[model samples]
Target: MSTQVKVKNRLSSTVQSLKPSGIRRFFDLAASMEGVISLGVGEPDFVTPWRMREASISSLERGHTAYTSNAGMLPLRVEIQKYLEERFSVSYHPETEILVTVGASEAIDIALRAILDPGDEVLVVEPCYVSYEPVIRLAGGVPVFLKTTMENQFKLTPQELETHITERTKAIIFCYPNNPTGGTMTAEEWKTLLPIIEKHDLMVISDEIYAELTYGRMHDSIAALPGMKDRTILISGFSKAFAMTGWRLGYVCASPDLLAGMLKIHQYTMLCAPTMAQMAALEALRHGRSDMERMIESYRQRRNYVVDGFRHIGLTCHEPDGAFYAFPSVASTGLSSAEFAEKLLMEEKVAVVPGDVFGESGKGHIRCSYATSMEQLKKALERMERLMGRLS
Candidate 1:
């Protein structure tokens, strides 16, 4: 008899069927090449602010390494609560409404796990952050993709949202100041969608990870809306604004019952966020505002430059109101998004993520992140221009 382990069939059919990340595929490909200019990864090119690092180092120097409570350090939670109240006008009690997780990724997973029973439907607005559908499925929920268009500025209106709802719909995941598209929703738009959310009685997992990176306007948290607080699971983290991607810390704010349930999952899955990273994040909230603003300004400059560059290259590009990406249509080139990206990568040594991976609605577009330096942006623009010239 063959003694080989039958590991193939033992894998969860759901996980086994899941597709690999399209973004990471390009990132890995670029990493393998020499002198490839990457606008592929969503991570900030900046390092963590010096003061934040100093704070973490101080904690380590003072022998502060220890496991925090399963819910996370009370001090950090308090600061997060205060930060949210001041920044977004959302109030979450540190003791009862907050759960600090490994990162926004984990917060999302736990939020879905806490609420979703088998076959419950989650309304995921697309071209969103890529993780939403996979995470939903992992939690035994069905992901119902609702496509948003460039003509709509990628906003999910009450009308569009209502059309996608069904009796099985239990929650909606919103990621404004969105990834891939850099789209944002205005207060008036949220006001319009409020009734639909209230009508359906859906729980909301609001990923505001890129909240502070808005280009011209302040970010509004949906949790601040009247009667929306209790049903909203608000997730935000320091990775984007503070350039602390390596820290792996993020927090979720929800009502007591929801938070308590998530905490139970968090305690068993991840005991606490890294103690050192928590201390660093506390310092960031306390004193890193100026550094964050400086980074935002740099990103704003880059956004303008990249947008103009795409237009100059004869691509129709929408102005992203927030986040670091510029989503430009490659349809004019008469090539698929994957074709455009691969050809550009090979010809010009420039890397960008194909938009289709975000969702079907994202096809014929490419996401180019402006989180890199001006010099690199200029080089990438020149290379892209050359490629466009050849294609045209």
Candidate 2:
């Protein structure tokens, strides 16, 4: 046989060196084990409410399965506008400012792709969502991490924001009602950040997916801050609050010019979000308040239960004011967060994500999601206590 030329590598170098998400690695392992009770995933455990499901089914049955506009159905966009104005005190013109996405995941990706230039820096708070750094890298941007520790209740302070700003900095991504840590920024915190953002002329990508899950105080949006709406890309979805993860419905609200750029990318990359999911999401916006209320209440009960349990078992846990996670210090176990999670799963059959998966600053902590049933949480706590007893 004639010798053939060696094939050149076709994959981009940008994708080659990227590490797989640390959150998914642990979940994959847990899924294969029998009798494992997982507190690992950040998704809500509740099923999609019946009303929303019926809306989707009805859409499908009516043969409304054809693709909608690339920006999504106009009615859904209008619904999103109303939802934002009424609930978040933010206003967006549906025709120009809103674009529906497959999920907030896609909204994050498209927003970065639309604005990033090679070597530009995107500031990310440490112990953030697993996807942010990788997405930023994929978009040809550098990820600059700012660490927020437990001493501050995991909230990013204004001084930290000032420290990270620089000539190359293009934007900052804020995930309040944060995943992993469950930390939320107050209105005053947003007020403090506004000057720094305005002074630098940097863009803000606010991921408020957990907006409906806050306790004690209402969730506030950075986009609502003075002089912020013009420079902000606000991303949210129906998943976390409405238990609509599988539905894959989300939207972004930004300036008309920004949305135009994002829409161009979306048109080519995604075509459009699922027609039926958008329809269902419209129903959710209109009528899912009671469902959201019930879910939040249940999560609050679970959060209290888990926080108290962690304290009793000798871990220092921050009482999260929002989101469904309990980020407790595992320093007492004298192990790194990864080691602690591995040991807990192997010895106690309980699964959790190591805090370090979020960043280097998360090394001594572990994130336990309390989105599951109270019964499961109670059992997990017992198993964790037993593991602590053995280690001590």
Candidate 3:
């Protein structure tokens, strides 16, 4: 007897207008299949290290379930401060400069929201991480993409960067040992970028989650450069290096004024990162260095194997100097990135992400995570080769 109300567009206009994550769409497709080999996910396949897990367990036993300060536990922030200084040569006052969050994802969100006002613009470097654009839009900032190409080794050039800046551009989201492409910039490269950033008076949201995973060269931070420290928001976590994705602990470091603004937003939205995760992250900074190194070595080996595998299979892959992904060109197969990926999944049962998911410049390629076991990597490569042979 009751009349039910039907709503066609109940979501916010922005939410409705925004596209669903291309990464998640492929993941959902892979999840529905019975025999798919997924290279679609960006997360590490490694488990949390035993000591960190044990630290969390012990904290739980010690009744650390109570909420930490909105800025997070001082002890954890202290350890984070130590780790950043020791690893990347950047120092911050733990008590005022660091705010722990649920994950690097949350760190990114709060940093954007704290800085952006309505109609402001942020320059997003791409082919890059997937989250930057959406987070900027959600923060009421316009995302002006600065696209990178394979010809440039997927590194943003000084010329390319300046072209994208506008008077309205308030910040730049910079990520490296980049996701999707696995590209990285050296200290010299950072030096060239510094003047442009300084000249424009841009605030940098530097996502260095993949910092510790770099190959050959030691990691460098933009925040470590002469006068860049105060203008940079440094975001990183234990998820990649310590194999603790599920632990979901991350931190953001910035000047006291910027940090205070971010913390206010974080307090209202996240309260604090999980207490157990904080305890585990404290353990990560204190004693998990060796474990982190071991995991990075493993990732390095996997990176070599997968990149070589792609090359052997006749796909042109840019050697990733950092991160656990290989961006291989599928253009020779005469299929669009989406077509190549979709067909590979249905026909060959190997699930890869289309490169364009990262940005328009990524269109002729595909992103394959090498974080999986060597056995799976081998099989996936063989299947891809077969698909290529058939297409040819």
Candidate 4:
């Protein structure tokens, strides 16, 4: 036997059994192919704006490279507090209720780990961001998926929520202006959910990362709802709104007790979010609101163009009120989402994420992100039309 065979298997069964994220497979393929117009990625194509970039560089020049407090830098936390209150009407105490994280990704992991015990159940809406389920399972919790259909514009209804609740349900992972499907819940829709949440006494890990990207109506946080401030962990970052994906700056707002628990986990796993990134995020919160507005307007234009193009080509598209994606049905082509995506990439040189990568309920649809240029969008649409014509 090789010397390596003597190594102990220290890895837990939970880590070994987790399925790899399906969204990554297509992205790997897209990266190697040339001349491909990819609508597969959810990231904005824009570079981080000039001022925020300058802040990062200036922080480096000032030699502010030391690790911050386990929670985050105080100044950045204060800025986040102000931004949340002014923009979303959500108030959080800078010192006690807020924790700056590496990204909303870290916030999700910390929130789940802090709250979930073995066998606890987490409620997640279908066609959500892919990270939610695996993170829950990694925390030794079971994920209960609640399917939201396109007929309802993919928003989870009160009836759906009530039907999925059980004694083991400990928390709900809510993502609006959702991933893979650009579904958004209205204030009225959230009102319907409030009672069920209260009756169940469930903690809500609300992921509002795309909150600023809504087209028509402003985004609202479930944490802002009456009586919810105590039970909800609101997660967001500067990625989508500020074109700051690489910055890895995200923050969470919760009750003082919850923040304390999460901070303990955060301190060990990640001592702090990067000091430079935190400075840049502070600059964004302080001076980048206008930049966010400009980006949102551009996304709105692309959203309309893509949704209309899909309809004109005889595919059914649920009108997306938020986010930079459109989920269009590919069932008429007699192909699974994976098959459609493969064929589109191989033959048409166009790339989109298969909807089923999000969950089982996302089958027969494909997610097209409009985060690329309009010129690229035109090329992708033409390629898709050709693929559809050939399939028919």
Against the true structure, candidate 2 reaches a TM-score of: 0.98
lDDT (CA) for every model shown? 0.93, 0.93, 0.90, 0.92
Residues 1-392, candidate 3, lDDT per residue (tens digit)? 99999888778887777888898888898899998999988888878888999999999999989999998899888888888888899999999999998889999999999999999999988887888888888889999988888777789899988998899999999789888899998888889988899999999999999999989988888899999999999999878888889888888999999999999998888888899998888888899999988888888999998988888888998899888888999888889999999999999999999999998878999999988998999899899889888988
Error of 1 at 253 (Å): 0.2
Candidate 2: lDDT of 81? 94
Q: Identify the runs in model 2 with alpha carbons over 4 angstroms from their true place.
A: 1-5
| Residue 134 alpha-carbon offset, candidate 3, angstroms | 1.2
Model 3 C-alpha RMSD to native: 1.3
Candidate 3 stretches greater than 4 Å from native:
3-9
lDDT of 4 by residue, 116-181 (tens): 999999999998899888899999999999999888899998888899899999999978989878
2 or 3, which is superior by lDDT?
Answer: 2
Task: Point out the higher-scoring one by lDDT: 1 or 3.
Answer: 1
Steric overlap count per candidate: 0, 0, 0, 0
lDDT string for model 1 (324-365, tens) is 999999999999999999999988999999999999989999
Off by over 4 Å in 1: 1-8
Q: Give the Cα error of residue 209 in candidate 3, in Å.
A: 0.7
> In model 3, which residue pairs have backbone atoms overlapping below 3 Å?
none
